[model samples]
Each structure stands twice: as structure tokens, then as C-alpha cells.
Target: MNHLEYVTCGTCSRLITIDVDAAGIIRNLSFLGGCSGNLKGICALAIGKPATEIKNTLKGITCGSKDTSCPDQLATALEQMGY
Candidate 1:
């Protein structure tokens, strides 16, 4: 299975690291330097989840009504893998 690591920008959530298996499924996820609630929710939502589902679910999620968000960063990471 493949692995990946990434960080999210904007909002109060500063960073996140996630490891996804070759099938684009999340095996693990961790949040660092971010707002507790948002980060916690992200981690929970990611674990054992497919990247495509996550990407679709989080698409266009604006952080506090802003332009970017942690979920978007996760989507970018998966898309970079050619999802």
C-alpha cells in the first residue's frame, strides 16, 4: 500500500498528516498545529475512508466561509496521487 503526508493551510487549522493505502483509502490521519475541533473532526472523518469519498464530501468546503480549508488540502493531496 502507498503512503502520503500533507499539510493544510488557511483557517485556524495549520497542518495535517494522513497516510492512505494504495486503494486511496485512509489508514491513518493526524492533525498538528490546528484548531482542536476542526482537526479532530478531520482525523475522525479520514480514518479508514476512501480518498475519493473524502474528496467528494469535502469538495468546496470553505474554512469559516473563507477560500480554503483542511479538507481541501486533503483533496489536493489525493488528486496529486492522480485520483
Candidate 2:
């Protein structure tokens, strides 16, 4: 299994740590240094979900009114995996 470490930025409400495996799949996720509810939401969404699926859901998502953010970057990273 491969692992990709990422940090979520912008109006993310909190910082997120994402771990993706070799098959472009999410192996585990942890929301660090952030709100409990928000982190729980993210963690719940990410766990057991495919990397591609997660990327697709978060792709092009802007933080607050911003056009780009770390979540978008995370999507890009997943896309780069070619899954």
C-alpha cells in the first residue's frame, strides 16, 4: 500500500490529514487541529471511500468564496494517481 500525506487549507474549518493507498484508495484519515464535528464529518466521508471517489466529490470545491484551496489540491493529487 502506498501513502500520500496531505494538508487541507482554506475555509476548511480545520486541518485534515489524508492517507491514500497504492490503488488510489483511502486507507485512513485523521482530522487534526480542528473542530470536532467538521473533522468527524470529513473522517466519516473519507474512511472506506476510494481516492478517486473522494477526489471527484471534492474537486473544484472552493473554500468559502475562494476559487481554490487545499482540498482542491488534494483532488489534483489523487487525479495524478491516474486511478
Candidate 3:
């Protein structure tokens, strides 16, 4: 299992913390300083899912005119954590 914290860039969320199991499954996920409901939805969708799957699904997503969204940053975090 692995526990990692990532500071976000180009998103409303300031930070993201994730827990991954030995099998590369996301056991828990949380974000700080982002959209409450949206991040909650992201958490619900991410828990118990494969980190690679989530990373693939969320990568390159953008918000408004920004180049990166919270989801995109989360994907970056997952990748940095060796998902």
C-alpha cells in the first residue's frame, strides 16, 4: 500500500491525498479547497477503483479557461505516485 500527498497546480484544489492498495487500487481519496460537491463526487468515483483507470479518465480535463482542472491535477498526482 502507498500513501501520498500532492500539492495541486492550476486548479481550485490546493492539495490532494490518496491511498492506494498493493494492487494499485485507490482505497481512499480527498481534496482540499475545491468544489465540495464535485470533489465529493470525484472521491466517490475514485474509491476502490484502479488508480490507472482514474488517471486515464481524468487526465487533460480542463476547467473554464484553465489548462487544468481538479480532475486533471488528481490524475497527475496518481501518476506521480506511480499508479
Highest-lDDT candidate: 3
lDDT of 1 at 38: 69
Per-model lDDT: 0.73, 0.66, 0.95
The regions of model 2 sitting more than 4 angstroms off are 8-15, 80-83
Question: Rank by lDDT, descending?
Answer: 3, 1, 2
In model 2, what are the clashing residue pairs, if there are any? 2-22
lDDT (Cα, 0-100) at 5 in candidate 3? 89
Pitting candidate 1 against candidate 2, the one with the higher TM-score is 1
TM-score of candidate 2 versus the correct structure, residues matched by position: 0.65
TM-score of 1: 0.79
Candidate 1 differs from the real structure by a C-alpha RMSD in angstroms, to one decimal, of 1.8
Q: Give lDDT tens digits, candidate 1, residues 10-79.
A: 7565556667787778888776676778678887878888988888888777777789777777777677
RMSD of each: 1.8, 3.0, 0.5
Candidate 1 — worst ten consecutive residues by lDDT sum? Answer: 7-16
Clashing pairs in 1: none
